[model samples]
Target chain A: MPGRGLNLTDLSYFPGCSLESSARESNISMMEAAEILGLNLIELEDWNCCGSSSANILDKEIAFSLAVRNLSLAPPDRPLMAMCPRCLYHLREAHQRLKEEPETLRAQERRWGRPISLGLSIIHFLEVLVRLGPARLQQGLVRNLNGLKFVPYYGCTLFRPPSLRQGSYYQGEMGNVLTMLGGVPLDKALTQRCCGSFLSAARADVVTPLVNEILASAVAAGAECLVTSCAMCQLNLEIRCTWEPRLPIFHFSEILALALGAQDYEGWFTRHLVDPRPLLQARELIP
Target chain B: MNPPAPALNLRGAASPIVLAEQDRYLARDIERLSRANLSRCFHCRSCGNGCPFIRGMDYPPNGIIRLVQYGLRRQALESHTIWICVGCHTCSVQCPMGIDIAAIMATLRRLALAEGAMIAETNILDFHREVLQSIKQYGRAHKLGIMLRYKARVRQWFADLDVGLRMLAKRKMDLKASRVKAIGEITRLFIPHWKR
Candidate 1:
């Protein structure tokens, strides 16, 4: 319903492991929202894992090589965009390392039998939205959020790491983008709290209290819900909280697509663990 | 319930840490590997205060730095602090000294694994192993498979069965893994030759 005649822009998208499997709703809604915004997110061919936190912990060599393999798969024409913050961090970190050590880059290129593009730009979906400007977003907006209050949760990986300090910081871009869509951003909450991450699987006891604290903060701030850019944060916050009247955790794209009046939202909303439909229905944004 | 134990007397006790047994190069090696300045940490405790999992860690982030600075190689490598960290970088961003505390923790974890130091938390290590195993086998993580293998390894099948079932009900965790067509490229990375 929005951006009916805008020229489409092509982007190479890396969904990573979480988005590809556990967070498929995020992937679908993100693609749907991008389509409305006239952004073509093409999947990279034969892409592998980003050598996640586990790989990075166990062996540095394997982690670097795994991330580099994805880099080799990305086409050099358009920028490579990722929805998952961890995947983006690993890819950019590997690229940074490769930039510093030309010999290692050459070795990786030789091993993969494909030339790794040193000039290829690695960007997040937030960066892409920011680059597209508020005017395009405003033009694409169909259903105004009707003053929906939400805590913009950027869980740990997007902009905190020291290795990524030199890169573009997207700390408040979520609030900025959501604000243009008539949503109220609640900044009083623990917006940058580390969402237990991989520890949720190994140590739920440690994660439960943390997730509860974050949700409690959002509740205390008078926020009706929480929006997060990372898929893992969405999953962790939804499943880890033991408190009653749990706040609905939304993937940033779901909210964005809903604003753009995407017709296939039922498919996406059905997959959410904490049902967001009640909140949407109450807001009168959806029927 | 018959006899009471006699009171023990303490006069002088030797400390467990002998200053002469310290590994002086421990700090330097960690700094080199992690590229973080260990000397910059003045025990500010900014990292520990901001750490979400500080309660889970035996020593605070700065305390681990203190252990490494003191050249307590065995203690530093064997401490629960390194294993408890999930590398969220909350400490790194909050550090006024520009020290990447998470990177230091990551380096310590690698060193601990390499030196065969006793892992403080075997369950966490087992989880990492399962995740890496899933990546190696399918090139992409299969959530169901990883969870099953991890639960099996930890020998706790019903630990988070509720959460697992909820995810299953929502179809969040797929039954089959999405595989990479060029699987050889991924499997090779797990081998030792890829390092060179």
Candidate 2:
């Protein structure tokens, strides 16, 4: 994690809920990226949910408890990375809430096998890649995404709950990586306006207009496609696109993997609720 | 000049008894959002820009411009929103036009049923009902039981074939947690009209 690029010999990972269910592309794309880069990501033998926005839907206690459970499953030394922002938010928020406040810390200290009073270095996958630098990504690229306008959509979870570190990091780092990958990273100032995350369930009617505003702006700005780091965003976007808009939505990792030739044109990419094949097909990038 | 509100009854099943304004737009009752929300739109076209799922729509969300302002209600209903909308409000929050597209959608959904608008994938509603039932039975979702039951209901048996095996292998889903809970208390949560 610290020495330039990921030393495959010392890398590890924890795939979160969004990838486990609805948005499965992130899982494959990241694996494909690691494989292409010769970085062997050792996935934990047994993993748990990061207790997304759902856990925090009402109270922080339930959210924190669920986050603690997932983190406890990780080994102490290796840094853990996740794709979904809600996962990122929960894990980071739980860690910060526990470490900063003693009552929370002491309570959590008793829960883990060895008192993990000092939090695990929970990181988002975006952090690992950006830190590796654009040069690292450039060396890994199989195709050039130059003229193909791209919109980087960081859903509510990735850049939200400003108090949380992991969520903040992905929001900050992915921009640099997008620049590094040689595509137009949408510079729209409100790029992180809550895509209403889990709010879609209780407020779909209110949310439809909200979703339209985002897609309209991205297209107006000349984005031919949008990139996301959260699985929920992928699921919500795919399910709600009832009206026509031709832009393809890609999990950030999948697009990066595709650019790096680590992964391209397969699996959930084919099963998307809305066909993103045109983007790939238009680019002659599809298999 | 503003056009007068359409004279369509938008009221109760063309009846022996006339209904009031509140009873109008009968379909809005089901989705719980209003059609007037759609009128505020001037088509600045913000929501369509940030949408991650824009590629799939036959109408593209920007058509909200064409839907409400132009009174393309029936045309909008027949679009995929009725079948695919999971009710995520990102569009509502992102709208610079201030149009409540989601509410417009809710109204459209209600109208679809009232007019018997070509009910596309009946599963969209069915999925919600099943999820509701699962949450009512357990305070939380019992993944296996719900998926199995939902799959049985929808006949999309092959969808996500990897889930059952994966959950079974992970041991996260247990059949025991799926007992139907205090039905009376949960059923009461369904009192008519206090809905979204």
Candidate 3:
């Protein structure tokens, strides 16, 4: 609840790998949204990758060491905010594990050449915004997305494995954000389904059907666009969606940025595989 | 014309079922490594039922757990299930016993790689290796470099080429690699863990 009291102005932000590369739109929009809401995001200096999904599967020790390195680098005074769900999950899980097993932390510290401690609370950006509450979000809203029907896709990492389950796992905060912005929030079952994740890179055949199911469900629910917080989910859904009547995938921050009257919204949409401008313009949510 | 009836065989072919002691050791090792408590699974099949990639798996999540319980190490480790698991954590979330089945899958993958077991899905493992190599080279992921290296290693140069082009056109893919300022520290962290 860092953003709840309005006293939380500055945050230590971990942009992770995807935010710097494929998910640049998410990074841009998130910064724009935060600026409008008067929140300061300080990027962690000399930070490395968070190990993501591949590192854990390949070697747990490496994953732990990597996350511990990142954790050690983060500023301890402010709460650490991770934009990517995978990074947040890995960092939080590693923090918990390292705290529980001091011996492991000691070993990692020996390897990393730095002392580590779980001083800062690692949180997702969505959680920070949610804790800020809808009323605070409403204060900056210039254009209400009245007719835009958005399906809030939580993906898997943000809300799974019991440790990371944020209350209901349906990403109600996304719904709350959309609702506060005067948009229709479709909190359907498919919104929380896995997007086949990294498998999209190796096995698209397996992922295509799953992605199709998610898209089909959103379309079936009469959704105009699919809003997700995860970068991998956005990539998989947009790239694998080859079927007819494709739905534009929007990072939740993009919508939030638009609602806050960001003028260069078209720049963000240009990077998306499926352009969302048509839907937004049709509803006059964007010019 | 009617098809001729097949003749019945007089004797059935028999195969030996040997329970190796090594299987028990392997099961114990997996249990120790994952800390998943294989005995806690009661064939509920909740993990299998909830698994999104069950259809692609040679053995379902419950079946893999059952294999672990019975100490069928060869069968469990060689299964396509471990390779196919995307680590979505659905099985772990839905497990009534609160077992982190995905963690077990990760252990199985490591064991499989260590034992040089025949991987049913080679591309997935290859992709993982390429991604790790990219992380090792650059502190952050370079999308273009990763994809190019992965394609070259997997020898599927043409695969997803169209999507790659589209991403490039859309400015979604970064051509240049970005390295963290403290890459030496990152390399130091990986060297010891990877050496083992």
Which candidate wins on TM-score?
Answer: 1
DockQ of each: 0.77, 0.04, 0.64
Error of 1 at A219 (Å): 0.6
For model 1, the local distance difference test gives 0.89
Candidate 1 residue B112 Cα shift, in angstroms, is 0.4
Kindly indicate the candidate among 1 and 2 with the higher lDDT.
1
Q: CAPRI band of model 1? A: medium
Q: Give the Cα error of residue B28 in candidate 1, in Å.
A: 1.5
Query: What does candidate 2's lDDT look like per residue over A179-267, in tens digits?
Result: 66666676663466556454344335545666677777787887777777776676556544445864677888877787787545567
Give the per-residue lDDT of model 1 (tens digit) for B63-181.
78877887888777877779889999999988999898998999999989999999989999999999899999999888999999999888999989999999999999999889999
**Candidate 2 displacement at residue A150 in angstroms:** 1.1
lDDT of 2 by residue, B1-196 (tens): 7754443222221212222322334333423445344545565657666553444344545563354344455555667644454334456657875555654555566667667777654555555555545544553345566667877887867755653454454343455543323334333333343651
Ranked candidates (TM-score, high to low)? 1, 3, 2
Clashes per candidate, residues 3 or more apart or on different chains: 0, 38, 0
Candidate 1 lDDT over A112-224, as tens digits, reads: 99999987888889888987999999999999999999999998989888766665667899999999999999999999899999999999999999999999999999999
lDDT (Cα atoms) of all candidates against the true structure: 0.89, 0.58, 0.82
